[model samples]
Target: MEEDIQISFLNKLSCFFLIVLFLGCDTPGKILIKNETQDDVIYRYYKKETDENVAIDTVSIHVPALSEKYIILGFGSLWTESQLKSYIQNLQKIELIKATDTIVLKDKVEIYNYFKKRIKGVHKDEIEIIIK
Candidate 1:
């Protein structure tokens, strides 16, 4: 009876470890922004927390027409994974400005879904912004 109980406990422990490993592998570690447009674009992103807009930073990349550029969103080290996820979900707004025209992308289901999908899997999540 003692040996049986020991084996059962070992089996459960192994299973738990396997589950943790699988989940950790699937969690996304980075955010990728791809610019798919015909002109150079400037992207500005802000974090929306409790109805306040906190400016993160601005990125300027010369993504040529029909090309893609990758931008990594790096949060500070003080933030936990849950905090990062919440901040990503609450991304207030993104502005894509080219020349004199400005385009705005809001935080909605589509955007959330996009980020959620990117947050999973073995690769960084990518958001493709297209200007038409």
Candidate 2:
């Protein structure tokens, strides 16, 4: 009877471990680039590979006026904590290369509201930049 009880407990523990490993601790840090400008703004992100502010003229992430571009960084289970931290740190050194000037919004109450079912973030971690 004791052997059966131990086996059942072990099975339940294994199942719980699997669930936590796959679901609970696996979330990537996300960034949203909001273009509150008059015209369409074209911007790009780069990591400080060697601590040089090389002007990356490549026109990447495009956000229309009053729209947003969501970028996802760091893989959940694939990346270690240190690696994710390094990526975020490197982003800080990158310069904001924008085609147009930013127009600060007065009422940003719904700034973070997004349609999760329809919209998705670009999963290019190294190139994805910006937090606020």
Report the alpha-carbon TM-score of model 2 versus the true structure.
0.39
Tens-digit lDDT track for model 2 on 31-87?
557766666665554444453667533336777767778666545522333544444
lDDT of each: 0.57, 0.48
lDDT of 2: 0.48
Clashes by residue pair, model 1: none
TM-score per prediction, in order, is: 0.43, 0.39
Candidate with the greatest lDDT versus the true structure: 1
lDDT of 1 by residue, 60-99 (tens): 4555566565554443312244544565676766676777
Stretches of model 2 off by over 4 angstroms after superposition: 1-22, 50-59, 77-85, 88-132
